[model samples]
Target: MADDFTPRYGEVEQMAPGIRRVLARNAGAFTYYGTGTYIVGNGAVAVIDPGPDDADHVHAIRAALEGERVSHILVTHTHYDHSPAAVPLKAATGAEIVGCAPLVLDDNGPRADAGFDRDYSPDRVLTDGDVVAGSDWTIEAVATPGHTSNHLCFAYREGEALFTGDHVMGWSTTVVSPPDGDMADYMRSLEKLLERDERIYYPTHGAPVDNPRRLVRGMLTHRKQREYQIVALLKEGVKHIPDMVARMYVGLDPRLTGGAGRSVLAHLVDLKERGQVRETDGEWRLCATSARD
Candidate 1:
C-alpha cells in the first residue's frame, strides 16, 4: 500500500497504464510528500495539478512530457502547491487550462490560506458532469467542493480511476476552513462520491487510495465523530473555537492548533445552520431542542 511514500523531488514514476506521477519539491505539513502532479495518457497527454511554480518542477514536467503534446492542463483547485505551475506549463506547451474557477473567500468566515493561486482562471470551467476528452483519455469532472468551494475531482473514464485532488486523500483528513470551505458541502460531497463506481483515487497528496469507498466512509465517520465531540463540548459550556480545539485536540502540535481551530469553526458553522448549535458574538452553544432531540 505504500507507493512512493518517501517521494523524491522531480521524480516521474508510472502509476497505472497511462498515468505517471511527478512529485513536486514543495513538501510540508499540509502537502505530505509535496504535490503529486499526474500526467495521464501518452503521445497526447493531460497534466493534472501542475503543482507549484518552482522552476525545476516545471522543467521536470516539461521533461516528463518528452516532446509529447500537452492538450490540457487540468487543475484540481487553486491551492498554492497545486495550481500555480499550470501558468508556466501552459506557456511552454500551449495547453489549455481546464478545471474549477478560482476560489473566492468571504470576509466574515474563518481565515483561509491567502497563498492560494487567486489568478488561476481555467480556460474552461468544468461543472459536475463535464467531460474533457483527449486522444487516449476521457476525464469526467466531478465537482467536489469542501476543501475549497471550487474543488474538483476528475475521473479517468478509461481507467476507472479518480484524480481526487484534496477532496479525499489517504494520508490525512482534509482541512475544512470556512467561507472558502463548507463542512455541510464537504459531507454532502463525500456522500456524492459514494454513488460513483471508481475503484481507485489518486489524490494530489499522499499515496493512491485503492479502497476508495472504505477510505471515504472512514473520512465521513471521522468528521461525524468530531462534530459529535464539538456538540458535546458545547453542552459543557465550551464557548469558543480555541477552547474547543484545546479540549478536543489534546496533545496536538501547537503549530497545528490554529488549523484545528478553523476546522472546529467550520463544524460549528454547519451545526449552526442545521439548528443543532448557535453562535452569538463568536461564542458557540448547543441548541436546547437539539440537545433534547
Candidate 2:
C-alpha cells in the first residue's frame, strides 16, 4: 500500500566469509520483505533472488558490486518476488539466469494475490546436485521441493553458507499453499537441510538465520503441530476442505485465508494419499477402510 515499500522493508547485510545478504523491506501479505540475498565470492559475484524488478533495487545491487561483474544469476524459486526480475537483470548484466522450471499450479488456481503465475519460466533449469560456477564461489543446487515444486537452495561448496530461497526463512515458516505447494515434500526438504551441517541460511526475503539447525527443527515441529491440530479438528466432524479450513484458520487475516486453505488442502491430500482420510462425493471424512494403529 505504501509507495515503494522496498527501501523501508529491505536491508543489505553481510552473512559470513564470502557472503552478503540483501534483505527485503516490507512484510507484505505474500512477500517476505527484508529477506537476505547473498553475494558470494569476490571479483565474479553472483546475486541470488534479485527480489522484485525495481530499478532502484537493481541499481543498488550494481552499486554494491562497484564495477565487479555478475557472472550468474541464481534463483531459489519461481515466485515473482524472487525470480521475475531475473529476465531484466539478465538482459542488463548478461548474467546467465538460472533456476528450476515453474511448478504446476493446482486445480484451484493460484491465490488472488499470489506473485507468480503458471506462465512464469526460468532460463536454465537446475536439478539437485547441479553446480553454478562463479569467479570466486561455486554454488551447488539442492532441490528442496515443498514451498513449491521448483524451489531450489544453493549451498556454497566451500562451506561458507547455504542460500535458502524460500525453503526456510528466519522470520516465518514458509507457506505450503497448494496445488503447487506440498506439505509432505516440504517436510522432506526440511529433513534434508537437517542432515546438513551448514553454518548459516541466506534466505531470499528475510535476515540470515544464524542458527539454521535450530530453525529447521522449529519449522518441522511447527508443521507437525499444525497437522495435529488439523487431525484433531477432523475428529470433531469438520468434513470437507472448506469446512475444515473455516474452523482451523478462524482468526487468520482475511487476505491469507485462501493461502491457509491451500495449505490445509495440501495436508488433507497428504492424509488421504496415506489412507487416513477419504473424499466421497465432495465430502471429506476419516477413511472408514483404514485400520487404526
Instruction: Name the regions of candidate 1 deviating beyond 4 angstroms.
Output: 1-4, 106-114
**Candidate 2 Cα errors over 4 Å, as ranges:** 1-12, 23-27, 102-123, 289-293
lDDT (Cα, tens digit) per residue for candidate 2, span 1-293 = 34544443344556666777665443566554543556787888888887666666776676677777888888887665776567667777888877677654434633433457454466678899998886667899999998888889999978558888888878666778776788999999999999988888877766668899999999889888887877777777777777777787788777777777778878888888888987778777776654242
Worst 10-residue lDDT window for candidate 2 reads 1-10
lDDT of each: 0.87, 0.74
**TM-score, candidate number 1:** 0.94
lDDT of 1 by residue, 1-293 (tens): 24545666787899999999999877766777788999999999999999988999999998888869999999989888889899999999999999988764443432233257866878998998999988899999999998888899999999999999999999888888877788999999999999999999999988899999999999999999999899888878889888889899899867567678878989999988888888789888788997775
Look at candidate 1 and tell me the lDDT of residue 104: 48
Name the weakest run of 10 consecutive residues (lDDT summed) in model 1: 105-114
